[model samples]
Every structure is written in C-alpha cells, then in structure tokens.
Target: MNKLKVAVIGCGAISRLRHIPEYAANPNVEIVAFCDPNIERAKQYAETYKGRAYSDYETMLKQEHPDAVSVCTPNSLHARTAIAVAEAGAHVLVEKPIASTEAEALAMIDAARAKGVYLMVAQNQRMMPEHVRAKELVDSGRLGKVLTFRTSFGYSGPENWSVEGNGTWFYSKDKAIMGVTADLGVHKADLIRWLLNDEVSEVASFVGTIHKGGTDLDDNAICILRMKGGAMGSLAASWTYYGEADNSTVLYCENGVMKVGTHPEDQIILEMRDGTVERYRADDIATNAGQQSSGIIDAFIDSILTQTPPPIPGEEGLRSLKVVLAAFESQTSGKIVRMT
Candidate 1:
C-alpha cells in the first residue's frame, strides 16, 4: 500500500501538538512537507519528521503535491489555504471555525467538491471518548429527549496553549477574528449540534472582553440557543477560567438528566426519574494540561484512503460556524438572531 503523502501548514502549537504527531502515528501516512511563516520553525519540524519545509504553502503544494494537507494556520487563513489545497487536488483537514465567514466556508466546500477531494474540519470534541459515550446514551433513548442543555468550554487562555504564548496570533483581532467565541465556543456549538442531532434555530448572546488586556476580542461569551426541535440551551466559552480548564455539558431530558465531563473519575453521570443513578468511565477528555489523541487525523486519513466523505465535512463545519456567527450578530444587535 502506498503511504498517503501528507503535509502540514502552520507549524504552530496545534501542528506540533496534534497534527504532526497524529500523522506520524498513522502507519498509512507519510509526512511529506511542513510550512510556516517562520521558516525556522517549519525546518525544525521537517528535520524531526523527515519532511521538506517551506515558508510558503503554495510552493510546498506545487512541489510536494501531497495526498492530503492539514491547514493549521490562523483562523482567518483557513479558507484560503484549504481552498488552495482542494484546488491542488489534495484533501484538506482544516482547523476549526473552518473559515472566517460562511461565504468563505461555502467556497471551500465547493472547491473540494469540484476537485473531487474531501474537506474536513477539525472539530475534535465530537471524537472525544466521553462525548462519544454521551452521544450513545442520548441516542439510546435511555435519557429520553433532551429538553435543555448547558455546555461550557473554558481555560486560562490561548496564551497558555499557543506556541507563541502571549504573542500568539490568537490575541490578534485580524488573525483570530473571534477570541474565545471562535476558539472555544465553536467546539461546544458543534458538540451540541451533533449530540442532539438538531439544528440551532435561534441565538442570543452577550460577548465581551473581560480580563484579557492585549486584545480587543472577547475573553468571555454566553449564548442562548434554541434548537429547531424545541430544545433550548445555553453555551459558554471563556478564557477567564483561572485554574483548571472546564469542558462540561449537562442535558436535562424528559426522563432524566445526563452530565458529561463534569467529574474527574466518572466522565458521564446519569440520574433517572426512577431514582436510579449511573456512572461511566471513559477515556479522559483531551485538554492542554493532559493532551491525548484527538482521533481527527486518523479519521481524516481514513476518509481519504477509503474515498468517503469525512466525518466532520465542510457542510457540518459550516453549520456549527453559523451558530457562532449568529451569536456574534446577536451580541452586536442586542436581539435574537434566527437562523434561516
């Protein structure tokens, strides 16, 4: 079997921590190229991973002609990079908030479709073990219909997670575009949409910059979502979480309530209307403090190799992104934004 030639753009923290390592672990993948604006960083990764490094992605794409590429660039660059990769006839696994705008995302999807290649968004939360089990429980009808939910994702800030630390592009409005809202909020938006298998029909939000000083982007956001199925929920994303990162969700259903990622030992907790309680232990949820395989790379590789659509395809990503975008609109307008 010919190993799938893969390349990574933007040798940032995400590339170093998740994309490169995950690809290296896949027996079916061969790292062929690495690209970053900082050529030295790219060269370092190339030296360690046995790939050629380039400062320009276009040059790398032209020369290497990889089978697939991971677009780990800043949020604003995702669309342009992914569209170029698709046009180059390579599959794309782009980092989340797939594009800065819905129009950009649609263009990327169209490019991939026209080129007969796959375009996947890296929404890793859906692949987390605990979330997977929670999905199963929800689908099993054991928890009945989810009527309400509260999902939150919070951490110290991107300064702690990014390779550039305090100077990371995450703190730049032009580069990041949306701070915690896009960085962390999109994950829960995707997760909730996927977990309930429902669309968010309406959104109202309060997004603001609370603690962070360097950037004008929001450091905290609280959004209220109304699903098409009549289920309602609140989603919070924050960079103001002082101590440990919190990625937890609770679902109130007709028959019971389900809690996920709230406890250290038991990742999922269930309370029944019949006065019964259940606990489940799954693999720990991946966080900056305790990193784990996201399963995104493997799934992206499998989709390319099998000639199937990716699990989190461009459309699904766009759907989740719409929720985030709506929240932004609601925050600015002080009114509920309804999705059409």
Candidate 2:
C-alpha cells in the first residue's frame, strides 16, 4: 500500500481522543473507515476525518479493506474484534486489557500469529519516557538487584473521563468486566513487568469499590505480587485519587530506591547504597485532555510499513492481563493465585 489505509473499530473516548487524532496526524496513514455501535458517533468521526461510517465492524473491514485497524472497543470485545481484523488481512492495534479473559487473549494472539499479521496492544505507558528510563536503570544493574517494588496508577473514575460522563460504558459490568483493576491496573502491571524484566509468579490482592459509592465496579485495587525473579512487589490501581492523577512506580533494590514519575519534582530519581542520588526529567504522559504525540501511532504505522514485529505484541499484553486476572481470582478466592 502506498499510504496505509486505516480503519478504527469503536468511536469511543480512546478512539476519538487518541487513535483517531494520532492516526490522522501520521502522514503515512489514511483513515478510511470508522465503525461504532453508535452510528452518530461514527458519523461524526467520519465527517471530521474523511472516512465512511458503519455501525458494523465487519462491514467496515470488507468495504474499506484497510491495511491497519485499531480495535478501540470495550474490554469484553477486544479479542473478537482484533481477531476478525487480523483474519481480514489487516494489522491490528487493540487497546489494553486485551480481552476479558486469558483464553480470549490467547486466542487473539493465536489468530494473528496464524494469519502472519502484526497484532499490537496499545499499552501506551510503555512509550512514556519515565518508564523507559526506569526500565533502563533496572537493566543497567545500577539498582543492584531489585529487592522490592511498588507501583500505582490512579485518576478520577472513568465516570468523569468516559464519553458518557457519569453513565459510561466503563462502569457497565457487561462491558468493562472488571473495574479499576482491569482499567488502570493492567497498565501498571504491564509497566512493572517491563521495568523489572520479569513476569508475575503469584498474586494476592485486596480489590474493592471503596470511593465510587454507587457503582458495582471496584474503584480501587491493591495486589501483592511475587515476580518470577524472586522479588516481591505491590501494585495498586485506583479510581479514588480525588486530586490530580498519581502515576508512579518505586523500586527498592540492594542499593536504594528508584522512583519513576513518583517524586514531587523529579521524573526519575535513584539513591544509591553509598548515598549518592541521580535524578532525570522526562516528558509528561499524554492524556485525552492534553493529547500529544505518544509515539503509538508512529510505532504502529512503522511496524506495518516495515513489516517488523510490533513493540507491544499480543503476548506481551496477555502477560500483563494475566496478572490482573490473577488478582481478581485472588480477590474472590481469598488466596494467592499462582500464574501459569
């Protein structure tokens, strides 16, 4: 394809604010079609971005034959939509928490692999500079064997941030499946795994709907995680952070603690065993309100253009979702859940 044609499935918040804008900004991408259950929303995106609107994704895929597709649907629909996109001979970029269940995620991964198509998960935090630096520090051995870690991601609940204000699809048990844990928690889970270069072995968690009083979904989640590398850590994802968002991670190693976006001023701070400290500043994370170049659009387009493997592939996303799923199991069974 000269300039890769792109189709977006689901014209929701993520689709409108991130995927659409980013793809529209990329010179190498031409958005040809938009599909959403809400036809009016799809029509709006189509009118603004120069695309045809369809209520059904299959029809859009068949009609547009886009070179790439962004699956920005709800938590429950990711696997089916992405798999279909890949089967239709298009590279797919699915939003995070790849699917509601491990089996579904695995199936999606298998389908893309079988079709010999690139299937990437939009785990955008991996593109954040602070996270990039922290992962570098751990890999550099400056931390002297990470002994323990703690990470948190929080914001005012999706009720305020979703496209539907208070009555968003995010709170629907039928769509979101799991609450804050699956929403925000999965992002941190993916980040910690990348930063530590290890997978989770076991998870014991306390998840609840503490602050969002009216919702049946959980507003907060705390997971005690044991990494495969024999290090332990705590992961918390919350929607109860009433103030500004707190997205931070701290790693305590034999040397000292390393903070990533966790400090008051510094974006990256490391204190050594000998008492010396190093600090590094990184760019602010991109959000829907103040959207900027996150490198996701570029990366996805590059992978398709170059026929290279995706940076955050389906398996990588599945690994992160597995931890979140394990936490849910732990919350329900009142026991530590061991990951496969």
Candidate 3:
C-alpha cells in the first residue's frame, strides 16, 4: 500500500501535539513538508518529522506537492489557507470552527469542489468512542426519546496562543471574532447535533466574560438549542474553568441520561430514572480523546485513499459554526435567533 504524502501547514501547538504525532504514528501517512509563517518553527517541525520546511505555503505546495495538508492556523485564517491548499490539488483538513463566517466556509467549499479535491473540517469530537457510542445508543432507540440535553466544553486559555495572554487573539474581538463560544461552544454544538442527528433551528443564548482576566472574549456562555425533532437542549461553554476538568457532554432521554468527559477508564456514565446506573469505558477512544485534530487527519487520509466522505465535512462544520454564531447573535439580540 502506498503511503499518503501529507504536509503540516501550521506548525503551532495543535500541529505539534496532534497532527504531527498522530500522522507519525499512522502507517499510511508520510510527512512530506512543514509550513509555518515562523520559519524557525517550520524548520523545527521539518527536522522533527524528516520533512522539508518552508515559511511560505506556495513554495511548499509547489515543491513537495503533498497529497493532503492540515490547516492549523487561527480561526480567521482557516478559509484562505484551505482554499489555497485545495487549489494546489491537495485535500484540506481544516481546523474547526471551519471559519469565522458562513460565507468564508462556503467559499472554501466551492474552491475545493472546483479543484476536485476533498475539503474536510477537523471535527474530532465526533470520532470519540464515547461520543460515537452515545450517538449509537440514541439512534438505535435504546435511549428511546431524547427529552433534553446539557453539553459543555471548556479549558483554561492556551498558555501562549497570543502575546496578550488572556487578552490574546482569543480575546481579541477583531482576530478571534468570537470567544469561548467559538473556541469551545462549537464542539458542544457539533456533539449535540450529531447525537440528535438534527440541526439546531433556533437558539437563545447568554455569553460574557465572567472570568479570565483581560480577555475581551467571553469566558463563559450558555445556549439553548431547539433541534428539528422538537428536542430541547442546552449547551454551555467556558474558558474559565480552573484546574484539570475540561470538556463534558450530557444527554437526557426519556429512559436515561448519558455522561462523558475527561475521566479516565469511565468516560461514559449512564444514569437511569430507576435508580440504576451503568458505566462504559472503551479502549478504542483516541489518546487525545477530543483534541479533534488527529481524528481529522486520519479521516482526511481515509477520504483521500478510499474516496469516502469525511466524518465531518465542511458543510457540517459550517452548520456547527452557524449554531455558535447564532448563539452570539441571540446573546446580542436578547431573543431566539433562527439558524437560517
């Protein structure tokens, strides 16, 4: 079997922690090039992976000609980089929230389609064994009717994501465009949508920075989602949670409730109304669990080799982004925003 040649476009923390390591471990992938605006970082990554290095993507695209590229840039730069790589005839695995806006996401989609290359959003949570199992339980009618759900994702802000610390690009309204709602909110939105197998048609939300000093972006947020099946759900995301606890999701059904998060060996917990509880732990879950970037890389390879659709397409990512955006809009308007 021929290994798929791939490039790591942004040699940042995400690339180092997720993409590079995951691809290195995978037998079917070859690290062909590393590109980063920071030349030193690119060189470092190339050295680490035994790949060529370039500070400019065009040079890398022309020289290495990889089969795929991972766009691990900031939220604002996702669309442009994705389109450029796809135009270079390499499939794109873009980091999520897809893009800052629907228009940008659609443009990327159009570019990828026109170039006859695949464009997939790296929505890794969907690949978590716990999440997959939960969705399976819901879809298999084992959970019966899902009445309501409360899901949340969060972490302390990245250590050096920006120069401003808490007031970095993540907090900058101009660069980030959205805050924790964009960072962590999108994950919960995607998870609930996948679990319910429906889109959020309407949303009402409240988002603000109650903590995370100097950060202009919201440190905390709560949103109510109305799914197409009349299932009412709530999503809460935050960057203010201190210590080790990070991401968590809970789904309440007519029969039972399911829970999963950062727990080791007992990530999935099911509680029933009958005072009985069951716990499930799957070894198939990725080491990073929900870091999402690695899953996206693996899925991109599958899409390229097998010609199968990615677990998370750009459109699906766009939908999740739309939900997060609608939540922000609703927070501003103080009314339910239809996700049209």
Runs in model 1 lying further than 4 Å from the true structure: none
Task: Kindly report the root-mean-square deviation of model 2 from the true structure over all alpha carbons.
Answer: 1.4
TM-score of each: 0.99, 0.96, 0.92
**Top TM-score hit:** 1
Whole-model lDDT values for every prediction: 0.95, 0.88, 0.81
TM-score of 3: 0.92
Pairs that collide, model 2: none
What are the runs in model 2 whose C-alpha is more than 4 Å off? none
After superposition, the stretches of candidate 3 with alpha carbons farther than 4 Å from their true spots are 160-168, 262-264, 283-294
Local error of candidate 1 at residue 216 (angstroms): 0.6
TM-score of 1: 0.99
lDDT of 2 by residue, 238-291 (tens): 998888888888889998889888665688998888989898988766554566
Query: For model 3, how does the per-residue alpha-carbon lDDT over 1-340 read when each residue is reduced to its tens digit?
Result: 8899999888776788888898998889999999888888889877878988898898889998899999987788888889989999999998878999989999999999899888888777788777877777778886678888788776666544443354445666666677889887998898888888888989999998896776567889999989988889888887766665466777888888877764667878888888798888864344332444335667778788999877788889999999988988998999999877
State the displacement of the C-alpha of residue 296, model 2, in Å, after optimal TM-score superposition: 1.8
Enumerate clash totals for all models, in the order shown.
0, 0, 0
